[model samples]
Target: MSHTLLSSPLQGFTDFKFRNAFNHFFGGIDTFYAPYIRLNGKMVIKNSYKRDIALENNTELEVIPQIITNDVDEFLFVSKYIRELGYKELNWNLGCPYPMVTKRGMGSGLIHDSKKIDSILHRVHNESDVLVSMKMRMGYENPEEILDTLPILDKYPLKNIAIHARIGKQLYKGGTDLGAFQKCLDNTKHKMYYNGDITSVAAFKELQERFPSIDHWMIGRGLIADPFLPSMIKNNTTEYPKNKIDIFSEFHDRIFKEYDAALSGPTPIRMKMLGFWEYFSQSFENPQKTYKKIKKAKSVKNYTIAVREILKEAKR
Candidate 1:
């Protein structure tokens, strides 16, 4: 059976620059979800969010805009804003597990509050025509939280629900609960897409065999760890392209140059690239050393040299 692969949105990593560069270089993800738009107690959409979903910025890809909020008004506001931008769908993020967000009764924390989920979906469906979908963890504190919320979600016509298979408190630390995920499959009437720990072709194959009913798969950190993953999965191959190092080097330089131009100073760019290397290092033979090499580069010149040496060594 064929599969539809989606690039799951990561807060700071999968921006327009990275998306475009990844699409150009890797070429497997069927769609990309822009990181959640947070209103921050204001009804305003940040310029950064605007730039991310701007049609011009994402012309080459099928992109979906996502919003992280518990406010109905904020949901409507962002929905209208994106509608005006010619986007027809908005993905609601209820999967974020960060303490700061969950403490406020948003993201995964909202799962336990079925009434609020019902109310918010109620108002949004009544007031807006924008198609809705969801990204969620099974629960914040426990897997059963989503079971209570799932019935409320069934009332609305959500496009689909992508589940990460772990609860909020786990915060990507423990293994995904396949048994809980199976329970989710049995409970919900909505189309369910699977997301979590799909890091390699072998891992993806394991999931495909485990859940033959699911055709849509969302890849989060796995894509960043190895951009080649999605395409390799699509081709049904375990081997990478012969020029993996050269391709990765070019892909890295593209994002680095683009981000370097977009961000103001060396410190910001360094920190940004460093954040990415936390995942990118996993692609190298020596993950810790590769990350340490990037982390130790205090100057931009030194960072460039470090990357060059890493890639050259990778080729050999």
Candidate 2:
């Protein structure tokens, strides 16, 4: 059976190419939520955002577009536009812990102002027909924020709420604080999807044992660090698909080729590859060497050479 506990968007890491490549070869995630489309307070969608999750060439997989916005009108405009593009669901990102976004009273910061959040959600719920979902954190500055804010979130009646199980201040550091997640489960009425630290088979089994009632799980960095994590989570085994190293390497190459063809210049290409290396190297036995060589590569040719070396070592 197809499994739904799978890859979630990781901004720069989970673009269309990565999603398509991962789904085709690695075989885990059933549905992917692309990184939040940041509209620059303008009416038009930016080219980069459009290119990230277009319903074009990426029709091979089920992909949902996520939007990050504080304005109701802008959100509605974009959400409706995506719906026209054949999307049945739209995800609102309220869990981004970045200062740049949170300071604007958007992302995790929105959780702080329950009244404003209710007003925005009230409008979106009443006005929009296409199902709306939210991915959020416990709060902006404190883990206890969800204790009260969850009630406000419940008032909106979202299709589902995915909680990251960390506060904004944590910013992906420290543990997931399962006690806080339990508190959310105790207090919130909305359907909840757990998102955080479910990286390995053992970890997933632990999560399942702890929260047997939760059927939905969202994986972000874990999926990138180990492409097979989702499949392992579903199978409940430590064993991964055989020849994982080779298949994963080819998938990365395919994404690199796609990026090389689509990106405008060498700098952009290098930047993208750098971002990939952040997690990609971790999968390798010689991750430190692999990442260091790639990070220090002076040109495309040299970078390719370093990759080939890593592949050779990986094969042995």
The number of the candidate with the highest lDDT is: 1
What global local distance difference test value does model 1 have?
0.96
TM-score of each: 0.99, 0.95
How far is each candidate from the true structure, as Cα RMSD in Å? 0.6, 1.7
Best by TM-score: 1
Error of 2 at 11 (Å): 1.3
TM-score of predicted model 1?
0.99
lDDT of 1 by residue, 1-316 (tens): 8899999999999999999999999999999999999997898888999999999999999999999999999999999999999999999999999999999999999999999989999999999999999999999999999999898999999999999999999999989999999999999899999999999998999999999999999999999999999999999998999999989989999999999999999999999999999999999999999999999999999999999999989988
User: Which pairs in model 1 have colliding backbones?
Assistant: none
Query: What's the true lDDT of residue 70 in model 2?
Result: 87
Ten residues in a row with the worst lDDT in model 1?
40-49
